[model samples]
Target: MSMDPVETFRIEAAELLEQVEQGLLDLTHRLTDKDLVDAVFRGLHTLKGSGAMFGFDDLAAFTHHCETAFDRVRKGEVPATVELVSAVLSARDHMRSLVEDEVTQTHRDAGAGLLADLRRAVESAQGKSSAPAPVDPAPVAATQDAPAPAAQAGWKLWFSLPANAMTNGSNPLALLAELGELGEMHVEADTSSVPPLDGLKPADLYVAWTVTLRTDQPRSAIDDVFIFVMDDMQLRIESLSAETEPRAPAEEIVAEAPSIAASADAPAAPSSIAPRAAAEPVAGSGDAKHGKSSESVRVPAERLDELMDRVGELVIAQSRLSQLASASTDLQLRSVSEEIERLSGELRDTMMVLRMVPVATLFGRFRRLVHDLARETGKAIELVTEGESTEVDKTVIERLADPLVHLVRNSIDHGLELPADREAAGKPRTGQIRLSARQAGGEVIINITDDGRGIDRERVRAKAVASGLLEADQQVGDHELLQFIFHPGFSTAQKVTNLSGRGVGMDVVKRTIESLRGTIDLTSTPGKGSEISLRIPLTVAIIDGLLVRVGDGRYVIPLAAVEECLELSLEDDLRSRGRSFISLRDKLVPFLRLRELFRTGTKPDPHQKIVVISTGSERVGLVVDQIIGDHQTVIKSMSKLHAAVNTFSGATILGDGTVALILDVGHLVAAGQQQEAQLRAAG
Candidate 1:
């Protein structure tokens, strides 16, 4: 099915908004960066143009104001300041709402208020610059998207598009019309490349243009006309000397044959080289805006997801085939099945690579969040990020966003102190928040660390006691005590604030993480800030699992979590009966008996096997009846009736079509740790 242009525009606009936001955030750090200023202006300009073309009038109109503000900054008429960045950041959000078809009166009012702040900031900068340079011609404030007066000099521009330009959806005529809007213009086409009637390719662009423009607009304005085709198109622009005539024909200087200038009144020539006017334009020439390659295609996320589901089914079918091939006596059938197994495995790997997206896309939104939080709390917060290139499953990235937002907010609101307080405490006035991601084994570990006053244990304990969440005389470890923060409606704040203090954030964060089959760890020091680490699987849809047996049932342990498999001697089992601990590499690792945990009500295998799995620094051994080799497991969520079960995360189809439960490694490891604690207490 073909994609709708409007939907495509909305998607592209969403991306453009990210660019604008990122540029604005970067500008905050380096206010005087001309390149950053120009980058932001160009993003806004393209958004305005594309939005207007896509019939998003409100979005275009709103974005135009921001574009105009940045345009002045581009021309040194105004300065890029925090206030301007903050105002534009707000404007960016409104643009997002419009793109998503969520525009309302509230958005309109907020847009107006933001625009007013933008105007004041621009006017304030202009008032300052007006005196420093008395002859500045730009207005202190302009409204209704007034065009800036073109630069006072004339310019000559020549551009030749690629042969497939028209086929790519770019209309050269629309570009000419935009040029016309700049100022007095004389446009001529060089149709020298046009083939004869018998040789013509109707969609091929065989013409070039030499435009003599007398406008007060900057060179960037003319550059914007060809921005869509700038990558491969040959373009040249030069300032016209005072003595040179702007309208001179191109053949006057060239040694080759004189160029033919097609007149606007010229009778319509061959359809192949027909020109389009800017007013009545065609769709874009398939120009991948913002430096993206035209060779790439935009597939709906749903389509990719559907493809993944099919691949998952194929993996299961392959598993069943592998089981059949092993049992078959026919050599030919076995050979064919083996070949299919290899191909299916390769296809599954390829499919997984397609689903992996860099974590950078997930981290991009936090810059804006940090900026707003800084303003709302009246604190100076700096966000530093690392390991952005680490890739995780697309689904994982999507689900993680909300949880990360809550953690960041909690850090800024309750963790970070005011600038004066930070200064008095012998720390830098600006509190720093570092968000980093990395791949650890089969999981992605994301850490949100801050340089702020850490969690106040005394306050937390008092709040817990007052709320009856804990007994005053009851002793608790720091790790267990911290769990109180995730209790719904729990807060230690002295007073309620707009951003926080009513509680209800950390608990949601915890729930979301647990839903993804992930775990969160929190650590803090009284004076030295806090850190929250989230550990989640790299991909949730499919996994390589080590199939094992316990009693009469089977289970699949995530192979990535599996370190090694070895037989547990009967003597060792009896020796460590109560402790359930194994000594490996001089370290004591806890072990869990799967048969006993599942209550299988069957005798244990004489020679049981131990599967060692580790998550970060923690390791646990699972003693099973037998190691049934490896299998490709397509994870299927457990039914709602079993949703509350903690030992098993999901179930998968086995080689023989039986339902094999997928073990929840994180939960098993935690259970092992708790068992050790109980054993120590008994001792």
Candidate 2:
């Protein structure tokens, strides 16, 4: 099927914009880095040229203006001053809206304002570069265009695009046409590699090209033509000068006639010289070959999700087969079932890896966020990211974006103190916000930490009392007090602000995380800054869980959270009847009797097992009837009737066609903690 050129351009343009943004952000720290400056300019140049080619005239025009501003920086006529960087950043965003057909009056006005600022910055820098004594431009031009130098400057380019390049949306003809625009050029095709008519692939490009060009444009220009096709394509470019070795008769004849003007309209030019032996293709901006792309194929995200769904079904079917096989006396059937089970397990693991993406894609956007936030708050804030390569489920990453934004914004606005305040407190004038992620067991833990004034406990307590969330003399631990921040319409800010502290964001963040079957915890030291950590499961679709029976009901506890299981002797159970706590290695670990918690009046088994599970540092034991071995739990959402149950996060279908509830470790752990607090208060 023929791909749409406009859609192809949009995808390519989006990637170029990302490069442009990254380059501009990098330049903010190292303004004098010529490579960074050139990188940014080249990205803008390609986007403009490609945009115009694909019929996005407005985008092409807008990007050209920004490209011109960066061109000045590239030529050393203007420094990449802070003002210029900021202006161009804004322009870059406007260019995106234009490309996406999302431009509005506001965008137009913002673009105008940014362009105005950019012009002023460029003019200011130009005044400095041009301040030196003016030299005669006529002599400089004559020196630049001297015949000897011009003759030595031209390049011969040979390009053989990938066979499927056209199918992948590359236009070789358009590329050759662009080369014609570069300078005086002759182009010819080499058809030696083309197969016979019976064997030809309609979508494949079988011919190669050789071009002799005379231009002052750098080799980078030639490199840009094959930017989108650089992967696995053969391209060679060599300097052409008087001293260069003369070509053979056939090669000379092939390279001589059909100047770019002569073959401009020819669809089938004659064969040219063979490609210069093994000259590696020079890639354009951000086209560095990391070897991964050569073996990769692009698949739509929905297709991946669909594949996961099918895999989940296969796992369920395999489970049913295993259950039936174990009951039958057929030896061959049992062996086949075990083999199928093994294969299904392997497939599940492979699917998990496919769904996992590096957290770096999530972290990259925060550079711009921090840049803008620093300016908005009038305080120097540096964002440091760690463990960006840690992989997590793509769904988890997408859902985490908004909550992380709220937390990071809160850290800057309410957690981090101003420069003067921080300095007065004997801290660095520039506050630091660090975002770090790592996979622990089956969960990905993400922490947003800021080194500034931490949460004010006394003030929070006072506000809690005033707001009637607590009694005036209510006593609570620091950790319990922190939970009040997640309460709906809760805030202790002295005054409301536009960005936050209007009693809005934090509760929503908590709700969103909980909906994803995750937990968030906040820790703060009065003067040592604050950190909020979110622990989320790696994937929600299927999980390895330990199935256990509590009374007559079955429950699935995430195996990732299980520490160990210990048999609770009747003597110890009877001795600790009222006070449900056990001493494990001299540590008093709390336990909850599931039969009592669930009010399942049925008598428990003589020998009760305590399943010790943990979330982070808190450990709690659940007393259950029996341990039913591990099962692959495909989670299904609870209906509206059971949505309010805090003890279970979701339900899963067992192999026996019975429904089992998945335990919510966060809720259970919190309950255990509260029970311990109550016992202490009574004592």
Candidate 3:
């Protein structure tokens, strides 16, 4: 299906807004960075032009104001101030609403307010930079040996856009009008490239243009007119008055062209002018200019999800075929099954790589968030990110965004000390929050670390006791006590604030991470800092799982979490009946019997097996009746009836068409750890 052009514009506009916002945020650190200034200008300029082309009039008009503001900064008319950047940032958000939603009265009101603030910021910046504004230099003609002046110059230009430009929502007339605004100009259409009527495609643009323009604006301003279409078009600009010879007759130049449609203000032509070499493709506007056109295609995310679903179904069918071939004695059938299995496996791996996106895409948004949060909280915060290049499943990144936002907000609002308090505590005034990600086996570990006042264990304990989450004066480990912060309606703050402290976010964060079959670990020092580590599976769709049998039911353990398997003898099982612990390398690892846990009401197999699974540093053993070898598990979500059941994360179909529950490794490990803690406490 063809995508809606308006939707395409919205996507592109969203990306441009992100660039503009990032540029504005970076300007806070170095107000006079010329490169960043140019970048912000280009982003706003492109967004305005594209928005106009796609018929987003409001977006175009609003973004134009921002573009003009940055354009002044680029030309040194005004300095880049924090207030100016902040105003543009707010304007950038309103521009998003214009692109995304129907223009409502509320939106118009908000845009007006933002623009008013933007004007005030510009005035404030101008007041700070008292230098007299530079006067426009006279357009000067030069000989071949001397360089052209930086001021405006007379120019002759010829250009044609890509053939499909009009079909892709570009308006040649609008472009011409914009060029007309530059200064006095005469435009003539060159129809020599037009094909015969019998072979012509109406959607294709075959006409080119030749123009003679006299403008005080710099050459870059002229270039900006075609910024959106420069990549695939041909353009040549020449200094019309560079020659030392006398001027040519106007009639002679007009007669040289087969078809001439001149503007009303056409002036006498100069002597024969040689065109400057074709302009190199303008660069540094955005990622599109970085030669990605030939290397990548923009695909809808839902299409990828559909493709994944198809691949998963194929995997299940392949598994069934493999099982059938293994049972049969036909060697040819078995060979074909093995070949198909290999091919499907390779295809699955390729599909997964296609779906993996860098965490940088996820990390990039936080820069803006931190900027806004720092301003809101009146705190000095420096956000440091590492492992941005680390790749994770796209779906994981999408769902992980909200949870990470909550965690980072909590870190700033609850964990970090105020600037005054931090200094009083003999620490640096600026607190740091670091976001880092790395792949550990088949899991991605994301850590949010903050160098600020850590969580107050005593406060958490007091809250827990008052909320009845703990008995008063009860003994509890620090880790256990800190976990009370995640309980529903739990808060240590004395009063509610706009950012947090209403007792709402942390519980949602915990539930969200758990819903992804992920585990969160928290550690902190009283005065130093705190870090929260989230261990999440690399992918949620399909996994290499160890299928095992417990009583009459089968379960699949994620192969990534399965460290090793060991046989549990009848003698050892009988001896460890009450404690449910096994000795491995001189350490006791807690074990859970699936039969007992599920209440299968069946006797155990004489020689059962223990599949040792782990999440982060915690390990647990699942005692099963049989180890049924490896299987490719295409995870299917459990029904709503089973939504509250945390033991199994999902279910999968076996070769025999039986449904096998996929164990939630994170939940089981936490359970085992809790059991171990309880036993230790009882002793």
Candidate closest to the true structure, highest lDDT: 3
Candidate 3 or 1, higher TM-score:
3
Alpha carbon lDDT at 55, candidate 1: 82
- lDDT of the candidates, in the order given: 0.79, 0.79, 0.82
Judged by lDDT against the true structure, how good is candidate 2?
0.79
User: How many times do residue backbones clash in model 1?
Assistant: 8
Compose the digit string of candidate 3's lDDT tens values, residues 617-666.
67999999999999889999999998889899999999878899999888
Which candidate achieves the best TM-score against the true structure?
3
What is model 3's C-alpha RMSD? 5.6
lDDT of 2 by residue, 1-683 (tens): 54467776787788899999989999999998988987898888778777877787777777878888886676555667887888889888888888887667776777777778878877776666646534433334433323244455676766666555565556788888879988999888777766699999787667778889888765555665655455456654555642255433222211221122222232221223333221212211113333445678666678889999989888888988999999999999999999999999999999999999999989998999989999998989989999999999898889999999889888999888889998999999999999999988888899999998999998888888988988888788778899999988898888887668689888899888877777899999888999999988899889889999988899999898899999997787899987999999999888999999999998888899999988767889999999998989988888899878889989888777788999988789889988988887887
Off by over 4 Å in 2: 1-8, 102-110, 128-163, 176-200, 206-294
Regions of candidate 1 where Cα sits further than 4 Å from its true position: 102-107, 134-160, 163-171, 186-221, 224-229, 232-294, 466-469, 563-590, 617-619
Please give the range of 10 consecutive residues that has the lowest summed lDDT in model 2: 277-286
